[model samples]
Target chain A: MKKLLNDPADLVAESLRGVERAHPELRVDHEHRIVYRADAPVSGKVGLLSGGGSGHEPAHAGFVGPGMLDAVCAGEVFTSPVPDQMAEATKNIDGGAGVLHLVWNYTGDVMNFDMAAELAGAETDTEVAAVVINDDVAVEDSLFTAGRRGTGAAVPVEKITGAAAEQGRSLSELADLARRVNDNTRSMGMALTSCTVPAKGTPTFDLPEDEIEIGIGIHGEPGRRRVPLAPAREIAEMLMEPLLADLDFTGGDGVLVFVNSMGATPMLELHLMYAEIAAILDNAGVVPVRSLVGPYVTSLDMAGCSVTLTRFDDELLRLWDAPVAALGLRWGM
Target chain B: MKKLLNDPADLVAESLRGVERAHPELRVDHEHRIVYRADAPVSGKVGLLSGGGSGHEPAHAGFVGPGMLDAVCAGEVFTSPVPDQMAEATKNIDGGAGVLHLVWNYTGDVMNFDMAAELAGAETDTEVAAVVINDDVAVEDSLFTAGRRGTGAAVPVEKITGAAAEQGRSLSELADLARRVNDNTRSMGMALTSCTVPAKGTPTFDLPEDEIEIGIGIHGEPGRRRVPLAPAREIAEMLMEPLLADLDFTGGDGVLVFVNSMGATPMLELHLMYAEIAAILDNAGVVPVRSLVGPYVTSLDMAGCSVTLTRFDDELLRLWDAPVAALGLRWGM
Candidate 1:
C-alpha cells in the first residue's frame, strides 16, 4: 500500500489537526474528533448533530455551521465515531432547548450514536431526539443488515431540517421535518471501481476493470451484483429501474433528482448520465421540479455515481424553496 | 489514462441533461448549461449567483437553494462556466433585485463571471456586483498569476452572506460581508497523489509514492512544491508555517479552521491532523473560535488535504451563526 504519511495509525488524528489549523472558526475537540461550529448553544435554539464513519467528504463536518448541524462527530476512516465523541459534541452544541441526533442507517453509526444519546441524556437536561435516515432504496428494508444503507439523501434531510431548526422551530417540529424529508426521498448508487480504504490499505473487492458493481453501499460494501460496463444509456437504466420501481412518482407532483458522482467520476460523465436518466424520468410521467447534479455526498476515490429522487409535495417544496445558508448547499438566501 | 467514459466531448452536455431530468424543480437551459432554482427571481430579495468549474461537488449548483445562491452555471469538469451560461443563470434568477456574483479566485472563473456580469448589465436593470474569493495564503500576492486560489472558505461566505441577503440586506451590505469573510480567510493545500480528470483520462501530474505535493489547487493543479513523505506532525508544519506568516492572528479575537480533504484523504487521517493542528494554533496564542475539518470542497479524486483559516470578529461571527439549509452545508437555521 502506497501512501504519503508517516504511519497509518496516526491518519485520523493527523487529519483532524490539519482541519483545526485550517478552519479556526470551528472548534475541534481533538480528543473526541468532533467538529463544532464555534458558537454553540445558540440560546433558545435546539442543537442538531450528525456523524458517521470517515471517507465521505464535506459530510457531517462540512455540514456543521449555521442553518445546518451544530456539531458533527467523525469516526475513523470508514468507521463510526465513538460514543464519547458524539456525547461531547452533543453536550457542547446543545442549546437550552434540546439536542437532536440525525444519523444515517449504518450498524456502527446507529449503535454508536445511540450510545452517545444515552450518554448525553445521562449527563445533562439537553433533551435528545434521534432520527435515523434510511432513505437508500438499494437494500431491502427487512430485519437484515441494519436495513438499507443511508446514502446521498441524508445531506438534504440534514440541511432542510437544520434550516427549520434555525428558524426556531420546536424540537418536535424539527424532528418531524427531518422525517418528512427522509420519507420524501430515496437513493441508490453503483460503483465502477472498488475503493481502497487507507486503513485497510487494499481495494475492498476485486472486479475486473471492465466490470461495474450495482447497488453498492457507501463504505465499499458489496453491491447487489456486478455486471459488465455498458453504454451510458443502459447504465442509466440499470440505476434508475430499481429506484423507480422502489418508489411511485406517477402522482406527478414533480421530483427532485440528484445525479451525484462518487469521488472519481467527472461532471462531464455525470452530465451524460444525467441526460439519459432524465429521459427515463420523463418517460415515467414525472415532472422534474428541482435538479441537482455533480457530487454532494461522496465516497472516497471510488469511481461511481448515485441517483437520488425526492418526491416533493407543496410543503416539502416550500422547505426546498426556502433559503438556506449552510456550507455545502445554499440558494436564494 | 484509465477511465470509464463514452466520449470526452459529450461529458458536460450529457451531465446537464441528466441533472435537468432528475431535478424537476430546477430549470436547466441545455443551450447553456445553467441551472436555476425552480422558484427563482425570489421575490423582493437581492439575487445571489455563483458558478465556476464543474468538478467542485456541492459547490455552485449544490448551493442553489433559499438564502444561498439563486442560480449556478456549470462549466466542463475543472473548467470555468462560460459567460453565456452565467449570464442566462443571472438573468433567470434575478427578481429585479441587483445580482451579486460570488465566485472563487480562479482565472477562468473570474474571466467568465466577469463576462456574464457585463452581459447581464447590458440586458436588464439588474446591477451585478462581483466578488472573487482568494483566500489561499500560500501564494504571495504578485502580478504573475491570480493571487491566491479560494479554497474551503468560499463555503462560509456563501452561507453567511446568503443569510444576509435573505434578510433583505442591501447588495452593498451583502458584498461587504462577503469581502470581510474573504479578507479574514486564508488556505493552503497539499496533494499526495495526482488525480486523473475524467476527460483527460490521465493523471494531472506525476508523483512518486514517497512524495507529497504542497499548496495545490482544487483541480489537481500542481502544488507550489513536492517533498518526500513525512510524518503528519511535520506536514502540519509545512502547511501551517506559510499560513501563519501570511496573517497575524496574534492578539486577535479568534480564528476558524477548516481542514479540507482533497477528495481521497481518509477521515481518520483528517482528525489526526486536526489534533496536531489545534495544538499548533493553541501554541500560536490564536484562539480558535470554531473549526471544520472534512472534504467540503474537493478535487475529483486527489489524495491529499488543504488547510483554511478565517479570522473571526463579532459581527461576522454572528452572521456565521445564522441558520442555513442547502445540500452541501446545513446548520444554524
Candidate 2:
C-alpha cells in the first residue's frame, strides 16, 4: 500500500508514459496501451509481440526492440491486456513477414491473444502465429493458468526467437523455435515477501516474516507450498533441483542459466543466488554456457528470486548469443 | 531479516564468490575482496578504479570492465574497503599510464583511498590520482560523511571518466574530468521503507505504514526530512527541484537524467517516477538528453528511488555515450 503512485487506476497509463519518455527507443500508444518499436514492421522480417499484466515490468514492454518483440501491450497490474490492444499492436507490427504473438500461459492472456489473432487476421492479410510459453514448474496448474505459469523463460525465449526471426525465419519456424526453447526451459521460484497490487492497496497474500513460500508464481498466486526460511545455499538447491530434473541437464551440453529477481530483491542477493546456482550446477557437472542474473521478469515488488535453465544446442547457443536491443535485456547489438 | 544469505558474517565474501562465478568477464580476488577486469592492464590506457562498501552493488564492482573501472574493491556491507585492497587494485590496474582512483565521499573511504594512493605510488611506482565524488544534494554533511555524501552520481562519473580513460586520457586529465562530472552532478533520494542489513538483521529504521523519509542516503542515514507520504508527482518534484536548483541544466545542453532505484523498488514505480520527472523538467524548460531508469546505486533492499542529473557538454556527452561492458550495466559494447 505504500507505493509511490498517484491514482491507483492510472498506474498503467502513467507508467507507459514514463516508459515512452525514459526510452525514446520506444513508442507508446496511450489509448491502446501498446508499446511499439519506433522502427517497426521491418520488411521481410517477422513481427514479434508479447502482452501481459503491467506489474512484471521489463517483460513484454521491455522486450520490444530490434531482435526481440516488435510490440508489447500493457494491462492493469496483474491483469491481461484486452484483445483490442493486442490486435492494434499486431496490425502495426506486421511487415508482411508475418506476426508472432508470444503469449504467456495465463488463461486471460491466452484467450485475449487468441481473440487478437483472429481480429488481426480478419483486419489484415498478414499471417499470424501464436507461441504459448508455460515453463514454470512451480505447479501443475494454477488459478491464473491452466497448466504451468510462464515465468522467467520468456526472457530467453524472446531473445532466442528474436535472433531466429532476425535471421529471416518464417512464422512457423519462429513458432517452432519458440516452442523448442520453452520445452527445453524450466523455472522454479520462491518468495521471501509478497507484492502488493497498487489498485488493491494491499499485499496479494499474507505470510509471517519468518517463513517463505516455495514454488511461488509471478502474480502472487498460491504456490505449491510454504516452508520455513532457508539460506541461499539450500534455497538455490531447492529451486535448481526441480529445473535440472525437469530438463536432463548433464555434461558438456551445457545450459543457459538465468537467475531472475522477483522484484524488491537486490542485485547483491541475486549475485549471491547466482553463485550458489553456479556451484550447484557445477557440482552436477552441468556447465553454464551463459549466465544472467537480474530482475528481467518480476512480480511487482515481491522479494524473491527464480532460477531458470534452458537446455542449449549449438543452434540454440548461437541464437542465444545473437545481439538484442531492448529496454529489459540489451546486449551485443 | 528474510535474506537469502548463508551467514551474516559471510555475506560479502559469498556475494563476491557469486559475482566471480556469474560474470566470466571479471576476476575476483577472494582474499583482498577485489573484482578486476579479467584482462587487466590494457597496454597504454589509464586504469580506472572505483571501490567502496559491498552493499551498493553494480557500483564499483559491476563497473569493472573494458571501458569502465579496471578494478573494484569490495568491503563489508556499508563499510569502507581497507587501504590494502585499494593499493593492490591500484597496482594491478596500472597499465603504465598511471591509475585513477574514483573514491566516494565518505570519511573512511577518503582516508583509505588516500592511503592506497601513497602505498601504490611507493610500492609499484604507479602514479595514482584520486577523485572524491560528493554529489548528494540531500545533506551537506551526515553521520557517515564529512561533507555531502556521494550517492547516485557515481554511475555517470564512473561511466564518463571511464570513457575518457579509455580514450587515452592520462591520470591527471581523467581526475579533472571526474571532478567536473562530480561537480556538475546533483542527486536527491527518498525511501518509502527502510533497508535491512544482513548482519543487523533488522530494518535500518522504523517508519509507520503511512510515512516516507525524504532525501534518504544509500546507507539509510538521515536525509533532509521525513514527511507524510506523497504521490509520485509531488515526490518527483521534491527530488528534482533541489537538483535543478543546483545545476543550470539549460537549452542546447541537455542533462543526463539518471532515475536510480534504492534497491527493492520495482521498475514499474521507477518508470512512473521517470514520467513525473520528465514532465517536471519539461515544465522547467530543461531538456534531458539522456535518461537511465533503474537500480544502479542501491541501499541493500530499500524501497525507493533517487534522481541524478548531470550537466553535460559535447565531450562529456560523447564520453557518456561510450561503450561499457559489465555484468551490472552493459550497453553499446
Identify the candidate with maximal lDDT: 2
The DockQ-derived docking category for candidate 1 is acceptable
Model 2 per-residue lDDT tens digits across residues B5-111: 89989988988888888888889999999999999988899998888997887786888897788998998999999999999989998889999888899999999
Model 1 compared with the native: what TM-score? Answer: 0.71
Q: lDDT tens string, model 2, A247-295?
A: 7888545899999899988888888898899988888888898888888
Model 1, A102: alpha-carbon shift in Å?
A: 11
- Which runs of model 1 end up more than 4 angstroms from their true locations? A1-6, A10-188, A217-221, A242-278, A285-300, A307-333, B1-6, B18-27, B37-49, B82-103, B108-129, B140-144, B156-161, B164-177, B266-269, B323-326
Considering the two chains of model 2, state its CAPRI-style docking category: high
What is the fnat of model 1 with respect to the true interface contacts?
A: 0.49
| Model 2 DockQ, alpha carbons vs. true complex | 0.83
Q: Cα deviation of A273 in candidate 2 (Å)? A: 1.1
Error of 2 at A181 (Å): 0.6
Instruction: Give iRMSD, candidate 2.
Output: 0.9
